[model samples]
Structure formats: C-alpha cells, structure tokens
Target: MNATATAAPKAKANATAPARGRPVLGRFPLPLRVLGYALVVGVGLVYLLPFALQLVTGFKTDPDAAAHPLGLVPTTPTTAAYQRLFGLSQAGDGVPFLRWLGNSTLVAVLVTAGRVLFDSMAGYALARLRFRGRSLLFGFVVGVMAVPGVALLIPKFLVLNSFGLFDTYTGMILPLMVDAAGIFIMKQFFESIPREVEEAARVDGAGVIRTFWSVVLPMARPALITLTILSFQGSWNEFTHFLVATQSGQYETLTTGLARFVSGGLGGGTQYPLKLAAALLATLPVAALFFCFQRYFVQGANSGAVKE
Candidate 1:
C-alpha cells in the first residue's frame, strides 16, 4: 500500500515535468515571467497604437483630430469624413471618391488576373518545358528582378509614349501585369511539384497544356492563393507606377487620390479626419484578403521550406 502510494506521486511528477530543451514558463522565476509578459504587451501596444489612432481620428472632427493626435477618444466625434468619402454629404468637396475606388478595383483586378495567367505560364515553361535557351530566359528573369523599379520609370514612360498607351488603362496595367518576382515565385513552386505526377498525366495521353491546367494547377491551390493575395495587395497599394502612368485627373486611383487629398486638397485645412478616414478605407480590402487567405499563405511558406 505504501509502495503503491509512493509510485503514484512519482508518476505524477514525471507527467508534470517539462520536455527536454523546452522551458516551462511556470518554472521561470516569477519576476522574469512578469517582465517577459510586460515586454510582449508593450511591443504589441506600440505596434497597434498607430492603427488605433487612425481609427479614432477618423471619427473625430478635423480640429479635434489635429488637437488630440494621439488620443484614443475623440473629443467631438463626427462622420463628416466618411460622408464626404461616400458622397452622402459634402458634394461640393469634389473628391470623386467612388471613381477613385472603381479605378483602383478595376486596375488591381486586371493586373492580378494578368499576373496569374502570364506568370504561371512563364513559370511552368521555365520549370517543366525543355526549350532552347530555357536557362538563358530564366537567368534573364532573375536579372530583371534585381533591377530597381525606380530606375525603369523613364524607360517605361518612353515605351508607353511611343506605343500610344500613355495615360491609358492599358499603360497603367500592362506595365505591372508580368512581374519577375511573381514569375520566380511560380517557377519555384512549380519546380517543387513532383515530376512523377506530370509523367502520369502524360501516360494518360494528356498534353502539356491540359496536364498543367487540369492536374498541376489544381494541386497548386496554396501557392496560387499566396500569389493571388500578393498580386491583389501589390496592385491595390501601388502608387508610384500609377503616378507616372497617367496624368489625367480621370485616371486617379485611390492611392494617388488619397495622396492628393492628404496634401492640402479638400478645402486645405489639413483635413485630418478626411485623410484618416480615407486611409482606413483604403487599408480594409488588403487586410480582409490577408485575414481570409492567411492559412493558404502559411501552407505555401511551409511547403517552400521542404527540401528537394
């Protein structure tokens, strides 16, 4: 009876012990644990403070926002900023918010589509298809990725002007449609896929395009989702390219329009509330996309970590 009682305590101790190389927080000195938790909370708050301020300022009156820039609570809350953005009130503001939104949406969508199609095709050809100068072409793609985008502004403008695509939607989108980084991403992902799967499809009499579209593409959901989210976010948030691509006010996208709005436009009194509101709205779509597809992104990242 004594031995059995002693054995139970030993078993319980064993069960409660931390695994090797893994430190248990409970076992840490109490002061250290408290300090660690405080540090973590402090860091989190620091990162979140700006976003919190933005959200709060969006509801404040212009003067209130300017006065209490860091305050979490608005002294005088108002929706005038949102009203101006949505055109419900302040029609005389002349922001054309909806037009900017529509232009951004259209450009982002088309650019994302073009990237997915063209990048995937180029990636597949580089990864799987045996062709003349295949290595040379892939090397060129990698080299292109190294070139700073800012340096290409003059060349892009020259080409666009020469081709009569200047100030057009085609110029805005076509230049961004096929990104070398995207092609590299797709190529690396395609290379990671097992060749046996393609061979099996070939055995079943599927051609190259058929196998890629029907078999390989279906298995590439995680990578595709990652690429889609990136393409959407990049295209949506793009500012510099859009700035140079079109000069007409009619072609102004959200980024450019928001820049203009924040820079003394909308009655020229800083318009903190309006700027904050516009910034908040602009951030929503990318945030939503990331939250929705975060799992796919994680899966894609983990998949890339696997050794060949």
Candidate 2:
C-alpha cells in the first residue's frame, strides 16, 4: 500500500514537470529562431537599403551620383539639389519650389479638415441617426466610390469652370473636401461600436450633437487618426485631379510642378536626383504621421477586415 501510494505521487510529480532539459528549447528551437530573425532582418534591409542609397545619392554631385548610382557613400556631397529646389543656387530658370510647397500645404490642410468634419458628420448620421433618404444617400455614396476617378476628370472640370472655381485653391480643394470612401469608413467604424455607450449619453439627457462631440468622438480616436492620416496623405499626393483642375503654374502643387519638371521633354532624360528629392520631401509628412500612428492602422480599417 505504501509503495503504491509513493509511486502515485511520483507519477503525478512527473506529469507536472517541464518537458525540456535545455532551458531555452522549451520556447523554440535555436536554428528556427535564428532563421526567423534572419528572414525578418533580410526583408527589412531589402526595403530600407534603397532609401538609404537614395538619401546619400541626393547629397552627391550630379556627375558623381550618376557614375555611382548604387553607392551609399558619396565622394562629393553637395547641397546643389536642395539649393535648386529652394531656388537658392543659380540653376537657370529656377523653380518656384517654395510657392509650390506652400500651395500644396494649403490645399492639403483644407481638404483634410473638410473631409474629417464632413465625413464624420455623414458617418454619424448614417450609422445611428435615422431620417428620410438616409439609405438612399448611403447607397449613392457607395456608387460614387465605384465610379473610376479617371472618368470624372472632364465632367468635374466642366462643373468647376462653370462655377469659375477653376485654377483656384477652392476648385482644387472643394472637389476633394468630402470623400465618399472616408464617409463610408467612418460609418462602418461608428456602427461597429456598441450602442450601449451612446444610450448612456442619451439617458443622461445629452443632445445628439453634444453626445457625438464629447462622448462618441473621444471614443473614436483610433478611427479619427486613421481617417486624418489618410485624408492628409491623399490630398498631399493628389495629382490627376489637380492636373485637370488647374491651368496656371502659379497654382501648381509639388505633384504638378514636379511632373512638368521631370517630364518636360518627350524623350525623358531622367533627372533622378531632382525628381527623387522632391518625392522624398513630399513623402516626409505622411511618413512621419504613419510611423507615429501605425498601431491604429494595424487593425486594418476596412469594414470586413476587422472582426469586432
């Protein structure tokens, strides 16, 4: 009886014991861990190495950069490209780069603000507030999104010109102010949130606007940030619409100005440094915002992509 009892406890103890002799092997195999890390590092290097080269190449003298396109270390780093960009260096027929930058900033900021406000308002109405024609309006917005943006170029231009908004900041910004996709995104995000929260605000005798502004909006920071970032980036990088909308060099954004600069001739000689530098400058703001709020985007703001 004693022997049997002792054996039972020993077996129970054995069952609870850890399965590995090597301490780290309990977590993962060493080679597999090493291979996984190697794979991640390799992929990271592949993507980052190009930007690393481009950053260095931007500083290089034109002839030196051309000769050593792949070199990360520039033999002679000059600020000529940047200077030309800012019209500091005497590159003949100097670009109004500052004007272009300012125009781009103005248009992007207005468009982003308008989209955020208009989209969130529209989304809130569609998600919770029931009124006449709500479904029809939502359906129309979806249909609009389905329409290819290219097809509307001529149509949109006619409308803008008819309104005499053509070549003006208003024209550039007005058409982009309320995006259907952004409205849809906001609606989907709002709908996914539990009704209980909104109900509490209602029970507290808060008005619709009051609740949405104070309680609901605060809860929607993640979605708001995502929408804001997208709006800003979209407006900043906007090209085709601006191309058709504006006629004057005075109104040119970076995209428009750079397009003319890079593709002035049909048999296009690549001014890689100039083109790339402009692109880099244009990309920095969006890149900075993304790196800062990338965590929210990890949820994949698409409607079906997130599973509550």
TM-score of each: 0.90, 0.86
Candidate 1, residue 202: the lDDT equals 99
**What does candidate 2's lDDT look like per residue over 1-308, in tens digits?**
99999999999878767654445533678788788778889999999997887788778776787788898898987877788788887746456778889999999999999999999999999999999999999999999999999999999899999999998888999999999999988888888788899899999999999999998888777788888899999999999999989999899998898888878531245556666677788778889989998887655365324635
lDDT of 1: 0.89
Q: Which stretches of candidate 2 lie over 4 Å from their true place?
A: 1-28, 90-93, 265-270, 299-308
lDDT by residue (92-124, candidate 1, tens digit) is 664688999999999999999999889888889
Error of 1 at 114 (Å): 1.2
